[model samples]
Target: MESAATDNTIWYVLVVLGLIYLIVLYRNKRATRRRKSRRFMEGKRMHDRDN
Candidate 1:
């Protein structure tokens, strides 16, 4: 019974760790994509004004 409880605790810890890893990975990817596109966005802004 104690082993079962320990196993459940480890599983919960693993799940939480995995979720945090995924969240960080997703944010990093989004940031990289934004960084990659920043130049294009800047260029667009420069040309967007017909004034």
Candidate 2:
């Protein structure tokens, strides 16, 4: 029973850590996507101006 409890605690900690890691990764991806889109828009505007 003691070993089972220890295993459970370890799994719980790992699950929480994994969730946090995924959230950070998701936020970074969203920021990168937003930055790319903004850059694309700026380039398009510049192209229009040149034409």
Candidate 3:
């Protein structure tokens, strides 16, 4: 019975850690996309100015 309880606790911890990892991964992907878009816009503006 005690082993069962410990197993449950471990599963819960693993699920919570997995969720946090996913959230962090999503945020990093979003930030990277935003940075790329911003850089692209800046380059476009510079090219336009040159022309």
State candidate 2's TM-score.
0.83
Task: State the RMSD for candidate 2.
Answer: 1.1
TM-score of each: 0.75, 0.83, 0.97
lDDT of 3: 1.00
Count clashing residue pairs per candidate.
0, 0, 0
Which one wins by TM-score: 1 or 3?
3
Predictions in order: lDDT: 0.94, 1.00, 1.00
Candidate 1 residue-pair clash tally: 0
Tell me the tens digit of each residue's lDDT in model 3 across 1-51.
Answer: 999999999999999999999999999999999999999999999999999
Cα error, candidate 3, residue 13 (Å): 0.4
Candidate 3's C-alpha runs over 4 A off are: none
Q: Model 1, 1-51: lDDT tens per residue? A: 999999999999999999999999999999999997997888888889754
Q: List the residue pairs that clash in candidate 3.
A: none
Residue 7, model 3, lDDT = 100
Ranking by TM-score: 3, 2, 1
